[model samples]
Target: MPHYFDTAHRQEIETLRQRWTARTEWPTWLLLIGVYAGWFGLVLASDRLGLWWSTVLLIPLVVLWLSVQHELLHGHPTRWLRLNKMLGYAPFAVWYPYTLYRDSHLQHHRDEDLTIPGRDPESRYLTAERWRGSSLWVRGLHWLNKTVIGRFLLGAPLALAALANEERLKMTAGDRHAWRMWLTHGALTLLMLTFIARYSVLPVWHYLLLISVPALSIAMIRSYYEHRPRAAPEQRSVLNEAAWPWRWLFLNLNFHLVHHDLPGLAWYDLPHAYQARREQWLARSGGFLVQGYGQLWRRNGIKAIDSPRHPFH
Candidate 1:
């Protein structure tokens, strides 16, 4: 990471961004619309298709949809700003607002923006003070989130509530964009709930639990190895740990180095482009971490408190 902050390396990053981000406007728009519609349709169809296929198949589809949204948010698969946000912010995850994500993400790109617990919305890592002050039960719950059981069963709602609290803050403060985002998301949420309430055989809460838990599980995987401040500039992102099924599910975003290198590279192109620049990136990161989430956990895991200076603390 310290090695990566050097001037000679930054030119490489700037070059990659300039060359890859330029694209045909129309195709980008078409791809954006198509992806959003396809995923949203899959959500509705999951109900009709019954629990078996929905969980086994559609859940991954939802993850891919989320991955596509990630790309769009970075200005990909389209040139039009509003259209891209519409696609990414559709609330398919049913909890997070896209605008909020966009805001926090830009902050994340700041040079000194390592993990800051209270200030950084997307930060799962804790500040030093938070780590010290947390009760035994709360610490246990946070640990639970990293493991498979906690991630799938308990982590989803916990994460959602945190996200919704942000929405509530934005709403109370009258942030117009946040207001619009929630309005759109709220209407969709209501429609989804109402349909389940009136006609579905399963309890409405059950349907929500079934779909949302698995969907958020994918989010858990996407973020699993993505951040670490100790490593510094180059090794900032945690490399992907999941293989095969989970890898494709998150659209190869697991390749953390390639992502940081060419932030504008499309999903399909990331792996290839990364492979080309692998050596340079690896050297740059000071080989901070090359393993996946499992390896990370095996090492007693990492936390936001790992940093010398955590804003939350």
Candidate 2:
């Protein structure tokens, strides 16, 4: 629970928090309204837009909805957890449940466990032993998952499969919590899909395949290199100076290290905090910085960024 920021930097963050107390979090509020309005508006207008065009437009809004969900889980735009959950609980993205994501992401914030297989729920790496023990086909899939195009195409399905397998095991072991969560998620997802089927021009399968899956893929871009195996925990996260488009879509999470350091800071405040002490943050992270996502794509287009095996393991 300790912050990575030094005393003075902590004081500066505290000052920002004080400023937040004096006024409303209008940006986060607007983001909540805007993402919902945009998504619903587009869905309602899909008949005129055609399937492909509507799918293309819907992808960004869905991605933004995921981002807004992230913000809500982080206690944004509201102080009450129940209110926040109510705002984000609709299964618009049509995959993971809000409660599941909330729990997993909070666990992922345990920085010291980051990038470690079995510990960090969001880790992309496997333990060295696990990698060594895998079948060739399994290893090949991991390799494909390392590339940009492959991650875009394979990331969502792979992640979903893994989550399903894990939850299956948990349910088999009589984990009632997991069962309850999935049942609730299933009911809500069915309701949302039903609404889309009745109201939208896009068919249910088309929306799932084109809009929902691709939205998850586009969202995965922010996380593609968000963390890496490193001896120092603070150095594991990357500071991606991504372009404005990505920043807006990911809710400024490209400043991943900053988010890890000050997890309580609002998404809108992240850029200012990082820019304020950019040098110190870079030093603290041991220079784990990417110029931008475009650079990431060009550099790791086909090649793996690094071994998928966790070096520390």
Candidate 3:
């Protein structure tokens, strides 16, 4: 790996960094078109060729849409928040509320904020206490959350339950936008369901699996080898160079350390920037997953789960 995550400011990168830039909405617009095109095309193709055949194309394309949405919401495809949200708000995901995602992901960027369990909505890591307190069923669920199959099968329901619990807590605290986000997302979710009910010949549940499940599965890959929470915060990061497929497919997200180093860095620049400081990132993460993502699977086992911390706060 040529790139690394650098904390000290660099003169070279400073010149390229944008404090603010004109928003570009085209990439998201193109992606939205692409997603629907994939859905309708797969629907037609499935009728002619059957789902197994369509899965070859369907799975990858759906993955692409989800990744693009991740970037768009992160201020990659645009500078303006509204424009950014407009492009990636595919109610089709049927899992994440885009507003909630934007809020949680932004929180994820705070330096003190990485993988704080309950505090960080996106963390999959478990705190030592949480790990110890688990019952047999929960332990099994945690194991499943770490794998592809578990993510596809149980990810959405588990995620929805978590998000709902969080939202109720927020509502009690009088979070101003709670109702609005719900109503807005509620509309989008309805549209997603309607699209399925009218067009997809498969059960509506099947459409959820085809799109929402895979979206979560891909998310698991991004976080899977990204962190391990050693006693030292600096050593907590991990890398996955064998993740070339997902990195490209996910707009360079597999370069997890770089994102952590300078999160404000836009998606387009993460690759070259990561390469530029690869050695430092490796040192920072205690030699990163430089060994490869295979280590994650071989040692961790397929069904693995961990939260960043317990008691979230």
Candidate 4:
């Protein structure tokens, strides 16, 4: 793959990395502490807050936790992958195992394969063959998945079902690693649900349906059109100039091209890095940019942004 930064830019980024190393990532550490503290604090206070209020408050924390997990998997706040895994392994989001996500996401960083179905594990597109084979209703769901409202309504369930089916196939094929991860995820998820059942006013079912699921739905917003298939690898990922609230919720991943260019760059530094070479970055992306999520909703709310079938396939 071609390097995004030239020699000078790379050296400048190295200087920033050195500075970060010198001070340590205190901000990320604070984020780790604050997100966990807020989530637990809200859970504990759910009875006083009432179900609706608590669910509303808790969803953002859960979404932030997902962002934190993304940071952890990328070696944020610390260099130790094991320690990061230890911090992130809790089934707080209540669906994916940390290791499962880590492995798939790292594969997704292979820019050459971005948005290629079967090659990119995180791809939203379907293979042409699969698209052709699907029933009309199944095809309708894929079309819906391309729309903003459809993504919020069906994204989490569709993604969860696909992941679950993949893991089931792996387990059936005697994949012990898959088995272990799922078992561990099951135990951790059960523990979390048990705690909510015992201590929180929100019912466990309600927590799953209202809080965790919706959090996943919201997180999916960042990725709804984060990548597209382009002939050039660098042109594939998007540069979404999302609003501050969206940026904070996704932890600067709104700068998707920047993150793709510098997978090891800390979340806090992404915006500055992108701003430093804004034009060059934009050029590299072949001008694949959006003003904000609001633009996406206004233009593609009910309309499919692009065909669900992979263009290359």
The residue ranges of model 3 lying beyond 4 angstroms of the native Cα positions read 1-9, 15-49, 126-133, 143-157, 168-176, 302-313
> Could you tell which candidate, 3 or 4, scores higher by TM-score?
4
Relative to the true structure, candidate 2 has a C-alpha RMSD (angstroms) of 1.6
Task: Give model 2's clash tally.
Answer: 0
User: Which of the two, 3 or 4, has more lDDT?
Assistant: 4
Each prediction's RMSD to truth: 4.7, 1.6, 4.6, 1.4
lDDT of each: 0.62, 0.88, 0.65, 0.91
lDDT per residue, candidate 2, 1-313, as tens digits? 2454579887878778778542488888888888888878888888888888988888998999999999889988888999999999988898888999999999999988999999899999998789989999999888888988778888899998998898889999999999898899899889878888888898999988888999999988789999988899999999999899999999999999999988888988899899999998899899999999999899888988888788877
Q: Would you list the clashing residue pairs of candidate 1? A: 241-292
RMSD to the native, candidate 3?
4.6
Clashing pairs in 2: none
Question: lDDT of model 2 at residue 202?
Answer: 88
- Which candidate has the highest TM-score of all? 4
Worst 10 residues of 4 by lDDT: 14-23
Reference-based TM-score, model 4: 0.97
The global Cα lDDT (0 to 1) of model 4 is: 0.91
lDDT of 1 at 240: 57
